[model samples]
Target: MKIVKSVLILILFLGIGATAWFYYPHYQIHKMKNDSMEVGKDLSRETYLDYYRQYSKQDIHHLAIGDSIIHGFGVDETENLVYKFSNQLGHEINKTVHYTNKGKNGMTSTGLNEMIKAGLLDEAIKTSDIITVNIGGNDVLKTAKKQDYYGAVKSFDTLQETFTKNLTEISMKIKEINPRATIVLLELYNPLPADHQFSDLADSLLPKWNVNIYEVAQQIPSSIVVQTTKVINSDNPQNLSQDGVHPNSAGYTAITTQILKQFSKEYRKEAV
Candidate 1:
């Protein structure tokens, strides 16, 4: 009877551990979403742009590079985040925001690092006043769908290590090329629907992946990490395209707003 009681106790402990394992990620996600919503609340866009007007040039050269998000895949040329961001920013600051996009479909963090090292983006990086990076979605998606949860988690751990290294190298290299340019790194958002099979796994891992992105931004000068999880998640299915991976025009607009808000907040911090 003592042995039976011991076995039951062990089972109960294992159940509790399993519950915590799943519940903790969801808790992190909730906290992150709340924090994202609070960002830039003290500063308005008008105020931020007014501050920019004081220090920015009459013409702004914007360079966007990364995967399909940067490339404006699954959306019209005018509807992409880059276009929306430049247009709105230019109008607000009264500057000519000329942009050159080097976004390629299916680009990964490793590929971006290789390109920067190979000097493929030298001229663009050097001449740009602003640069936005949106790579890593492909990296996350590549490992998030494994059939075994443990296997997927292991793969993501390996991927995160490589991704962090690559992102750090990429940001440092870009800063080396253009010390004055502001680098905006977009945080990866979970694209899986809440009801999807891998949704829980994605929720479990996305916060960690985004943490790496944030850490790299902190280490690099003139770098900003823009949070997109609040605006681009499974809850907003209408924002996504039919493919369910890429954002539609509306989704791009939401992302562009987040970028502008975060950029302006950074500006406010410096001005204050």
Candidate 2:
């Protein structure tokens, strides 16, 4: 009788331990996200534009849209894709490039469509020489809640359809607004390292989404999808930030290189 009682007690303790193990991270993530939204809420899009006007009195406008990657989420202004690319392009072309960023932390593809519909992106898009997008991460991220790879995969299946539709619509809208503006969509990377529990599934699923991004870019005029997985999120994830989700200094630098490469490719084609 005592032996059976001991086994039952052990099982109960294990169950409780497992529960705490999973939910603790989720709770922390929720808290951090809420705090970030609260902070970002006050800093409106117009504020960023006016700040740009103060520093650089130039007509060159480069608008960065989409999620936190585009927003430079866990990094300083210098370490963000927007500033790095803008600065490099300015130096390369001998033009003063004014950068405008409309990166939201928890944005999905649909959210981006809504933002465009609301005319939040109108002035920025119309004035932009180049428009960079980093979206669809949150769409897949919403599925990570299951903590079960199989379940997460299933969740991603549903999100894939809507993500494709919304992203296509977004590209069409951008083209309609400004046909001359080059649209560069950042490819998805597996933020979770290979050894991590959900890494394999994330890697497998991310590429599927990338194909959609590539296809959409191909269909849209003056648009290209920049690959990020091989550069930012590698086998060891060396370029990742401390959070293992966002990019570090090296990762952002890699991103800047890819963006310039795509532009160079077009410039060469045009010159030839």
- RMSD for all candidates, in order, please: 4.2, 15.0
- Residue pairs clashing in model 1 are none
- The lDDT per prediction is 0.80, 0.73
Runs of candidate 2 with Cα error greater than 4 angstroms are 1-58, 146-148, 266-272
- Estimate candidate 1's alpha-carbon lDDT, on a 0 to 1 scale: 0.80
Q: List ranges where model 1 is wrong by over 4 Å.
A: 1-51, 143-151, 267-272
Top TM-score: which candidate number?
1
Candidate with top lDDT is 1
Per-residue lDDT of model 2, residues 226-269, tens digit only: 76765876564767899888888778988888767655543211
Scored by lDDT, model 2 comes in at 0.73
Cα-based lDDT at residue 23, candidate 1: 69
Model 1 TM-score relative to the real fold: 0.82
Q: Write the per-residue lDDT of candidate 1 for residues 1-272, one digit (tens) a residue.
A: 99999999999999999888666655665564444345365645333455557654788889999999999998888999899999989987878889998999989899999999999999989989889999998776666464455676778778889999999999989878887777888888887789998788788778777877776765665666777887889889888988888989999999988877765655422311
